[model samples]
Target: MSLTSVEALTQVRARTLALVAHLDDADLERQVDPLMSPLVWDLAHIAAYEDLWLVHRYAGEALLHPDLAARYDAFETPRSVRGEIELLDAPGAREYLRDVRDRTLQAINGRGPDGVLHEMVARHELQHTETMRQAMRLGGLLAPGEPHLDPLTGPDGWLDVPAGAFAMGAPDGAFSYDNERPRHDVEVGAFRIARRPVTNGTWLSFTEGGGYQRREWWSDEGWAWKEDYDITHCPDAEAGHPDAPVCHVSWFEADAFARWSGGRLPTEAEWERAATWSQGTDPLQAVGQVWEWTSSWFGGYPGFVAHPYREYSEVFFGRSYRVLRGGSWATDSRLATTTFRNWDLPQRRQIFAGVRLAADPEVN
Candidate 1:
């Protein structure tokens, strides 16, 4: 039999804890980067969110630790300043999480699996698991083990994606984030996208050929950012193998590279079409290797409605953030669906962000 909501929750919860099993108290407490929460904070916050949505909201119970809500609130406490806030220590946080989980299990037992909240909480925890994985990588933690399957390989050239009207975003009955809601038809023109992400070797060529120093190859804003940050080489390049996808690149940088290669970053629609194309066979490759940047700004579709997690998508629906499709190796598979939307500031490059070149269809 397929796993029930409770079984799925239990399995994901155990996996979340197991991801941090190697960390010591100091490691758990340490903030890997200004953009990310401390490991311990994520651990506790996962349970806290579960408690808030599943136990309290759905079950109509009072918050077990109402006092601790502000500390874990993403809006109330910015990630950069989370270290200054007083938080539960390792053991205490673990105990608090256990208590919340126990209560959540009891609540789940009483309730049926038809509620959307249960699936929401399960997906929410899985999202955090990906976040924790990113934190561990940023903190220079070692990989847990070798991947069971060999790394995927792709063809050398761009894949032809014929233009057509395609349904974008998640379809009905599928559990998707609010941002991917209100599935609509999008008309995408013919385009050719790279089969695989730009590899380290390709990026090295750009760097060696003075890609960063050439102001013309970059936008006005991109040039300013490049000079301000003094970014000469790829971030974390030392750790990347030649065949590994190049990551930690900003959208501006990716755009510059695309321009330099006589192409452009695929618009969000194009990226989605290329990613989800099932007419003949799957043309794209190396999708989940890294979060590929697109040329579209973060925004909502027509008839979009904010779900229970309003702040999750509503707060950032504007031009401030760029859309990134696909997921990285650090992302949990459950949270890496085709319709899943990940966005970040154009200047931010700390995440597992990368590039894919897209071009207009060739004329005969």
Candidate 2:
């Protein structure tokens, strides 16, 4: 059953808090890497985001912590400097979350609330929860526990998608980011996509066979990044399984692996078409396990218009960022809808990401 807007918001808030429940002051405050903020900062930032959307934008109310806006605003303060900023203490951040949620509840219950905005805010928190987990995983703060991956699934090989036309992107009135808007028809040639994502075992084969040393397999920029970072393996390789879809694989790594495996990364449209088909007889497995890199760059749909704020999606539409589909283990299941566009630097391997290969129908 679909949750009431209030229920969804409440549940997302609960999950956000639960994610950080055991972490104490020091852990929450520590910045594990420059790419991510301190966990406590994330907590406050979540609160601040809710306050911005719910209390300020939706409710048209006075700011609760207006003074802290400069500090907590994501664009105003980038991740590189977040660790140095003096943010609310862990307990204080929790209190801020509660306070913001209290106001959010009032806003949603008072008048006919814009359920779409409520959903957007709820999903925003959900995304942040995943971000917080990324920080936890990287910081070695998470306790030893079972991974979310399942054993190998689906048919042993490829799923063929015939040459055809299909409507791409989410339709109007749906709950999706602006990047997924302006649904349009697209034509693609016949291709075969993997039944399952490329697993750690497959990736390990590449690395063991000197995949990193073989410069020919990597793009010029990709090889440069590999050598610059001295990156040799995924972050948690010791804990990974041959069956589990690889995590922490960057677009560069995914591309190189695809080349080594005699395939290529699927374009965003192909990925979407396959995902749409996955719903029926043409089943695709191991989705929502890790964000799958696509061969497409992050760009606006043809008729894209920035809704509410340009900062959300418009700012990042460009060649510098590569598109990723699916959702990671830490992702809230609801947010992994087919058209939800995710983008990051091609060289960023810190986020939980994996690869899926595609090739011409005749190749296999």
* TM-score winner: 2
Give me the runs in candidate 1 sitting further than 4 Å from their true place. Answer: 144-152
What are the per-residue Cα lDDT tens digits for candidate 2 across 1-364?
Answer: 1788888887888888777777789999889999899999988998898898888987899879999998999999999999987889888998998898888888877865677888888898899888888888788876456348766766768888998989999977668888998899999999999989987787888988988899889999999999999988775554687787888888998999999999999999999999897445557787888899999999998988998799998898877999999898778888988889889999987778889899889754
Off by over 4 Å in 2: 143-146, 278-280
Per-residue CA lDDT of model 1 for 1-364, tens digit only, reads 1467888888888888888888789999988888888889988888789889878888888999999888887788788888878888899889988999888888877875544777788888888877777777778763566221123475678888887999999998768888998899999989999888888778888888889888889999999988887878785544467677888889989999998899999998999998889878656888887899999999999989998767989889987999999988777787888999999999987767889899999999
Candidate 1 CA-lDDT value: 0.83
In the predicted model 1, the residue pairs found to clash are none
Span of ten consecutive residues with least summed lDDT in model 1: 142-151
- lDDT, residue 285, model 2: 86
Structural similarity to truth (TM-score) of each candidate: 0.95, 0.96
Report the lDDT of model 1 for residue 316: 96
